[model samples]
Target chain A: MKRRTEVVLAGLGGQGLILIGKILGEAAAIYEGKNSVQTQSYGVASRGGFSKSEVVISSEEIAYPEVLDPDVVLTLSQQAYDLYKNKVRKDCWLIYDSDTITGEGVSDKEFGFPITTVAVELRNTRILNMIALGILVKLTGIVSVESILRSLEKNIPSQFRDVNLRAFQRGLEMS
Target chain B: MHDRIKFLQGNEACVEGALTAGASFYAGYPITPSSEIAELASIRLPAVGGVFIQMEDEIASMAALVGASMAGAKAFTATSGPGFSLMQENIGLAIMTEAPCVIINVQRSGPSTGLATKPAQADVMQARWGTHGDHAIIVLSPASVQECYELMIQAFNFAEEFRTPVIFLSDEIVGHMREKVILRDDIPIVNRKFPKVDPPEYRPYQPGEDGVPPLAYFGSDYIFHASSSMHDETGYPNNVPDNAEKVIKRLYKKIYDHRDEIIITKEYETEDAEIILVSFGASARSAREAVYILRESGYKAGLLQLNTLWPFPDEKVRQLADRAKFMVVPEMNLGQIISEVKRVVEARIPVYGVNKVNGEIITPYEILGKIKEVF
Candidate 1:
């Protein structure tokens, strides 16, 4: 019943962070029947560089796309974590990769986990964003777990749907 | 309208809107922030039995759209500032020949490639007069992603209805932004009014009562010449002083006469406000927020969102300016549309500008800061 929820997915360019952002947006719009906007920022390098995708979900039309002091910030790289942790609201949910980040400046609102480690242990490193997405949905309740899986199934290639779904479930159990 | 909703980026919404408007041909070169339009068009056009081409450059892309229009295909192309500069000459050709087409400029920062990946509304003036001619133009700006979708459909309609090139002016913020939109099945689509008479009787440049001349297809039995030269009623090249005047006047008259219907602006909380904030595209979104924040702090503020920029919505702005004591113009660029706002309000009241040119957006806080300083 929240009117607006701001979520940011920040990571390196190749980490599939944009994908996770899109899935979250689709889950909100397509499955949960909410209004969503997904905007992205990336470096000129186009690969393995800093990138961020900001998504805003609302019950009504959203005028502005850029999220200011996002409610939930998910970071996959240390640089992303360091850059955004200082910027978000004090009570903001700062989720980061425990394997890659030390949770230095943000220990109070931090929900650090070994995101990459879990994906690697699951034998698929590409599902790193999916794990974060799973945890994000659970902690914020922006959208249901079923909405995330449904969006993933609609977007991901048929060959990789099952593995991505399993990774999302692994993420859900984290919280 | 489909009850189901979907999250769509501004670029993706543009493609869907064009398709809904019956755009059958797309010719554009890929540019950052605007490439998603071409990418989606390439796939969507083919699926709908249309054609999509990656032209060698922006020039050819615009030229191709003009050529496709002659053959009676609703066509459009997208580009950024640098590419928009390339398409200027051809945009003039569309204006001179009275070709019906649409051009989407997903504006980015710079006079020359200042920031390819960033968002800026600096191209507002360029879109109005970049083609280097005294001709009429209709440029519509969209503030949100849904407007990106909705305005594009109107852009196509305006192009066809007036037999002129319509510019869908979107900044990078609106072009790259994503939003939930209901893909309505009931969009009002307009096609170019075709000639009903035989080939021998048709005069391509002759305007009806509305000043819009009927368009004839290339392969159709009703044959008519299409050229970039100043032509008379018959669409033949005529350099006579009187005939040239008629050609130019008619071209301007069509849109000018219909300016009331063509220009659109949204006024918010302005009934009793002492200050009016004027903005368009992403800047308007920020300005709207500033209005509410100002109200909460006991200062009465209103917002005038210019959805139609080319004709400049002067009458509506004048009325609003008369009621308000001051006007604040905020944009991502230094001061383009602010000049127009000043011209409209004249010296009657103070007009202030909040400008930023660092390839970053003008935030609500900045607009509020400017208002605070002036008051």
Candidate 2:
């Protein structure tokens, strides 16, 4: 049987969910030599509308690109949590930002991290997705931290790379 | 672990393929789901000393493409459904004038702007007959990012080789999705055949033995006239009935004579298939998954994925129909390609359609349900 991991990163449109999703897929595909596909959907509104990116990493060829049942989900907004809370399997790992979302009755395998609060402390709220990414990597081990760092170097602009790396390190420590 | 492996969206992959195929000019108006091609072209083309222009509308963009191609530049443009509709006139002009160019339509759902950012294969028929008249066109569809890169080169090659406009029909799902693509450096590139005759002896519309006229750029030493109106071997407007018939016949013959080379399809697990699912573009991905699920559960299912949409692989589908007991076509529109499949099958086997226009993909389970309901 081929090993596969389906991940959904959900948040508001401006929270960079798609960026983190690309980084995860790039790490799996470019660095690890695994097959990966990333797809995203967002509403019409630029900033506040629902946004989600789905990444499927597999040892075999991926025929269906969409995530039918996600093994891991990260939600940075309350609306995103509500949307995917019931869609995922019960044993799936659900990670949410405790700073903005309440995970009262979501899943037994749930971990709530203060993702945005840590980003605030790191002096840049925009790197919240990278911090959330670090926590997800630490908890699930879906991708190596070194691979993710290499992907970040290729994907992130040069001026903001230091701050984003700092935020990812902070989240790794928190996890 | 090669350095050439990179993650790329389907739209970006198309631009990379275009650049690799010696595309030196791009003129397009940005639209949702396809704007990435233009955005990336704007940045990439300048570095390579190519021209990138944001035309006033899709109409002007296509006109600019024809103009640029006539000047000996491999040119392309990207747009969606509404923009595609706007470009039909110039596309028809490109066909009539035998100007080589490429048009990438990252299709969205619509009669007219129904869903701007959603995926749809509804443009299948439009791509075939959208520009009108009794002319033949080449259209290629890609289901993955890698295919987007690979087929875009083929699209350019077909356009240049046939000296006609080729349409790269993509949908929102394939356009927006990102996947690993190996940027192979050893791709075979094809360019238009230039006339070997002197400037005075060049007859623009005169066909060689293969029924395709050798093209000469406008500003070269060659001086020739190209008009959308009916013309004879000299390429000026003749408007005689005999000239019209000869000109139109050559247009069709140039493509249909080389049909076997232009048409491409992929078949999976069809050696002993009882039921075959025929699909194209993004929905074909779902159909392939359905085939896998069905075969795993003791069903003899197979898939025939059409990578070339326009000269509709009637011969291949008909061959599959001879072997399979049943055929199903799953598309994002209300039975566009299914009609062609049914026509080719000739009611020998039961043909079914799984159609969806609700801005969501036709899932594999949905196809399985349709199969079980009929099985």
The DockQ leader among the candidates is 2
lDDT of 2 at B314: 87
Q: Clashing residue pairs, candidate 2? A: none
lDDT of 2 by residue, B68-141 (tens): 99999999999999999999999999999999999999999887878887888998888999997999999999
Cα lDDT computed for each candidate against the true fold: 0.88, 0.92
RMSD of each: 1.8, 1.4
How well does each candidate superpose onto the true structure, as a TM-score? Answer: 0.96, 0.98
How well does candidate 2 score on lDDT at residue A115? 83
Chain B of candidate 1 achieves a TM-score of 0.98
In terms of TM-score, the best-performing candidate is: 2
Model 1, A42: alpha-carbon shift in Å?
Answer: 1.0
lDDT of 1 by residue, B112-132 (tens): 877778888888888999998
